[model samples]
Structure formats: C-alpha cells, structure tokens
Target chain A: MSKAEIKSPLPGMFYRRPSPDSAPFKNDGDSVSAADVIGVVEVMKSFHEVTAGIDGKAIRFLVDDADAVMAGQALAEVEA
Target chain B: MVVRVLNPGLSTTVQDLGRPGYFHLGIPIGGAMDRLALRAANLIVGNDEGAAGLEAVFVGPQLEFTRDALIAVTGADMPIKLDGEEKPSWTALKVRAGQVLSFGFLQTGARIYIAIAGGIDVPLALGSRSTYPIGALGGFKGRAIAKDDELPVGNAAGGREGRSIPEALRRRPGMPAELRVLPGLYWHRVTEETHRNFFDDQWKVAPEADRMGYRFRGGRPLQFVERDQPFGAGSDPSNIVDSCYPYGSIQVPGGTEPIILHRDAVSGGGYFMVGTVVSADMDLIGQLQPNTPTRFVKVDMDGALKARADRAALLDRIRSVFA
Candidate 1:
C-alpha cells in the first residue's frame, strides 16, 4: 500500500471534529473515500473542511486538535 | 449570462461603489468594505470601476457559471478553485458553463471580491447596487445571497483574459495596518489621557465587528468630561443629541471600546464620535481580521488629501497597465 499525506490548504487552527461536542470526523485506522472530510481549519471564526482527495485508511494526525497550522502543512497521513 | 449560487459562504452580498448624496435622507452609504479591491476586480474584468460584484466575507461562495464568462477574484487571500482546480486571484480567467467556482480556507484578510466580465445585474436602489441589509435596500433582493439564487449578468464590456495585476498593487494580508484618523466632532468629550492612549496603544479588533461597524478593545476606558446633559442628549456619557454620522466615524459607547463605523453603518446615532477614519484608509479597515492589532494615526486634512491623491496615483498606474 502506498501512503498519502493530506495537507492543509490554508493557515488556521486545525480541529479533528466539527465542533467541541462532536465525534472526530475519522479515527486512526478508519477508512475514508475521496472527498470525505477529515478535519476542519478554523480561521477568522469561519470553519473550512479539509477533505481527502484519495481513498485511504486514516493514519495518525500530524497535529493535535486545536493546534495552529500553516498553509500547506501536512495534517494527516493516509495509507492507500 | 447567469450565475447560480451553490453555496453562500458566510455573508455574500452584491456591492458597488455605493450611493453618495443620500446620507441626509437617513440612508447609509453602504458599499464595498474594500473599495480598492472591488475596483481591481472590475478593472480585471473590463467593467466600470463601480460595477456590482460579490463581496464574500471570511469564506467565499460556491458559484456555478451558467455560461462561458470571464471573471476575476480580488481582495483577501482566500484560495479559490474552479471545477476543483486551484486558480490565482487578482487576475482574469475564463470559465466554462457548469464550472463550479469555490473557495478554500482563508489565508489572510477578511473579504474577497469576485467580478464578472459583466457586472451582476440587479435592480439599483438610490443609484447604486450596494446592499444595506439593515434597511433591506439594494443589491440582490436587498439581502445577502442565498443558495440556488440565479443572478443575471449584464453585457460584458470585453476585458482581456489572463491579465494580472502588478504585485506591488496588491494589499498583502497579515501586515500591520495604520489607519489615519481625523479627530473632530466630540473629540473634546474624551480626556487628554484617553486621547494619548488611543493613539499610542495598539487596539485589538473585537469579535463583534461586522458590516455595520468594527468594535475595538484595548487600553484604559476613555472617560468623558463631566457636564450637564443637554436637552435630547441621553444620560449616558457617550450619548449626544442624535446626529448624522459620517462614514468611518469612530464612536465609543460607555467609553470602553471604540467602534469605527464602516460602509454599512447607520446614518445617524447618539453615540459620541471622537474621530473619522480618513477616506484613503477605509479600505484598510476592511482587510482587518478579528483579533488583529491596529493603531490609529492622527493626520491633518492636508495629510488626508495627500494620502487620497497618492492612492489615486497608484490606481492610475494600475489602469495604465491594462490600457
């Protein structure tokens, strides 16, 4: 299996779940399809979803939940 | 041509230069928060300087073109994509029918301006297409656009595709901004110590900011000079006889936080205004993001006019590029 990395498109605070009370979009080892939302980046109080472009099994997230991330920073690794 | 709104990200509204000469009638001069960006977008698409366009805040909208048309996105560093392919901003590009134009996470700044070859064809109110949602007047049905709203496009003026603005002309985000203010009208209400604090200290933008006004927080609370309340002036120290408010007026209620009224602010209010943001720097206010630190620089009328002239010269230089 080839590994792929999902990168953040913009700089913001990364979140594993949609909100504070919600479950994470995907857990480690979970399977995801193309276009499946993996996380969200909150900027200027607006939230934008980060989606997977390739189907794969979720690996570990590169950043912790609520950590500040920069544009093009790798968020998570996926095993295709 | 027609454009369909697939997703109205945040508050997307159609705005132009705005209608002047109507403030006396109790109508606010609601228009584009960043007029410089709006003009740049229009210039890229070969439209009039004041042509109507979409002002997307923080997030941008998902727009599907119904026909082939030329478009340009300016202001804010929000990444834009067409048909799922990333595209550059501050440049004109051609879009085919059924192509979806969407945005990525905001990189910097707060709003993005999207201009088509032909401006958004909406019924003009008071000689402008700008939206004033408080009064529910002008723009697309006088409100922010909704998903699935089909907006008609006017005739294209024919601008060259692939035209890009010079790098120096673009306003980079994340840079500290200094907005020039002309202190006047009720300036005497605040104590001298507060006046010094207002100019010397950095003020952080509060989250309560919006199209109506940008409220800032920082420094010691300003105190008004004790005086007997005049007739029709409320008891609050910040309150005065309800009067006309010029665009960019800064009013402090309870003297705790200062609110700089913007393009869509109310025409008249009882709040005490200590200063008016100069016309040239109003665009800078639009680019300010929440929690960003800013400083108000005091400038005289001559300085303000000079700044305005300098901006005009810069715009002229940009126009020469396209000409």
Candidate 2:
C-alpha cells in the first residue's frame, strides 16, 4: 500500500465540508478516488474544490477544518 | 496569430481598464485587479496601455502561442518559463510558434498580468474586454477563459524584444500595506471610540478579499452611535438607507469586519461606509496577499487629492520611460 497526499491548489481558508452545517466531505478512514473531492479551498472569496487525485483505501486529513493553507500545501493523506 | 489555452489556471480572465459609465445600472467596473501591472505589461509588449490581457490570480495559465510574438509578464513574481526555458519576468521576450508558456508558483503578490504583443483580441463589451463574471458580461466569452480555448491575437505593433520596466517601476506593496482613508458621509455614525479604534488598530486582509471588495479583520468590532432604528434600515445600528458605494468606500456590516469596496463594488448597499480608500493605494490593495498585515491611515480631502496627483505622476514617469 502507498499513501498519496492531497494538496491545495490555491491559498486561503480550507473547509472539510461544503458548508458550515454540512457533513465533512471525507472521514479519517474514508475511501477516496481521483475524482473524489476531499475539501474546498477558499481563495479571494472564490471556492475551489480539491480532489484526492489518487485512489485510496483510507484517507487522513492533514490540516484542520477552516484552517489557513497555501498553494500546494498538503491537505490530506490517503493510503492506496 | 492565435494563443491556445492548455490549462486555464485559477480564475484566468481577460481584462483591460474595465467598462465604466455603467455602474449605475448595477454593472461594475470589472477589470484587472492590479491595473498598474496590466499597464506595465502592455507597455512592455508595445500594446496600448489599456489593451486587454490575461490576469491570473496566484496560479498562472499554461498557454501555447501559435506564432512568434513578444510577451511580457508583470505583477506577481510568478516564474516565467517558455518550453522549459526559464525567462526573466517584466521584460519582453520572443516566443516561437508552438512554444508553450507557463508559470511557477506565485512568489509575491496575489495576481499577475500577461500582455502579448498587440493584445488579446476578444470582442469588447461596453468598451472593454474585461470579464464581469457575475454579470456574464465582457471578456473572452463573457467569463473566465477555459482550457483548449483558442484566443485570437492581433498583430504586434512593433514591440521590441528585451524591453523591461525598471525595478522602481515594477510596483508592489511593502509589508504591512498602508491604505489611506477619507472619512465619508456615514463616518459620523460610528462612536468616537470606534472611529479611533478603526484607524488605531492594525488589521489583516481577510480571505474575502476580491475584485468586488476587501474585507479586513483582526480589529475591534465597530460601535455605532446608539439611536432609534432608521426607517427602511434594519435594526442593526450599522444599517443604513441604501446609498451609493463609492469606488473604495469602506463599509462595515453589522459593525463587525470592515469591507472596502473596490473596482467591482456594488452600486449601493444597506451598509454604512465609514471612509473611502484613496485612489492611489487601490492598486496596492490588489497586490496584497490574504492575511497580510495592514493599517489604515486617515487622510483629509486635500491629502486624498494630492495622493491622486502623485499617482498620476508615477504613471507619467512609467509611461515616459517606455514611450
């Protein structure tokens, strides 16, 4: 098994869920794929989705919810 | 010649000086956030100062040019690479046909401008090629440029290769950018303490900074002068009868974070404006990174006008250096 990281494409605040009241996009042990959205990065008031980019058996978030992040900052790690 | 978009980087858009004279109808003056950078890039490529060009925020687009042409990049310190060959930024360079141009991660500032010789030949809407995405109005299809799009380019007007702006001419904000404000019509609404605190405390650019407005945080909440609710305004003391938002007006909603309207600001809103940032510093605001520390400097009417004149002189100097 190998672990892949999900990185933010742009800098700003990162959110695990679509909205404040919604469930997180992924849990610590959730399975993910290249097309799966792991979180959203809010840059300059615009929201952009961040995909996992790799198929994995389990995912672990590296950054806390609503935390400030930079471009290419690792957001999560997924084990394949 | 034509330019092909290999990858449309985040929020890539065609913009010039923007369409004015229509904000009354709810359309904004939507254009490049860093107008000075756009103008500098265009001048380096020998295009009109306000020629339509690409404005990329943080991430720059990968573009493939169809023919040899001069191109210049300005604003953010995004490394310019042509077909794996690194090139100097802020200087005009010649690219051969089929050569691809790309950029590295943003090193400084928030946005970058790419001015091709003769400019991007997008159809103008309301006298501009700027994209007003919310209105679905101008620019390359009235929206952000998408991948695989072939954008037309005009013939170069004799731009010289290697033309570059001087180091002093390449403008970007210093650490802890200072934005000067002129207290406005509703400035009296805030209590005396709030007024002092607004300028006394240092604030950080919030993540909500954008073309429309920049929200500032890390300051004390505003305290309004207690009074009976004004009619048509909400119960919040910060509420007001909808009034025009001047280009740079600083509005505080619910007396919390302060939001300074920019080029694409709404025509009017229910929030009260405490002041307006001077025109000279608006470009600096555009280049600021989110979370950058900032302070508000109070300016009188004379100070504001002098700052405007100083800005004009700076532009004049830039124009003459290249002209």
Identify the candidate with maximal DockQ: 2
Q: Write one digit per residue (lDDT tens) for candidate 2, span A1-80.
A: 77888888787899999999999999999999899999998877679998988999789999999998877688999898
Among these predictions, the greatest TM-score belongs to: 2
Task: Score candidate 2 by TM-score against the native.
Answer: 0.91
Docking class of 2: medium
The per-model lDDT (C-alpha) reads 0.87, 0.89
DockQ of each: 0.15, 0.52
Q: Per-prediction TM-score, chain A only?
A: 0.93, 0.95
Tens digits of per-residue lDDT for model 1 on B1-323? Answer: 78999999878999999988888887878889999999999999999989999998877899999999999999998888999899999999999999999998777788899999989999999999999987889999999999999998999988988998988998543445688999987999889987887898788776567788888888578878999989999999999999888889999888889899998878897999989999888898887776677888999899999989988997898788788
Query: Which segments of model 2 are wrong by more than 4 Å?
Result: A1-6, A17-36, A54-62, A76-80
Q: How accurate locally is residue B65 in candidate 1, as Cα lDDT from 0 to 100?
A: 96
Superposed model 1: Cα runs more than 4 Å off: A1-80, B172-174
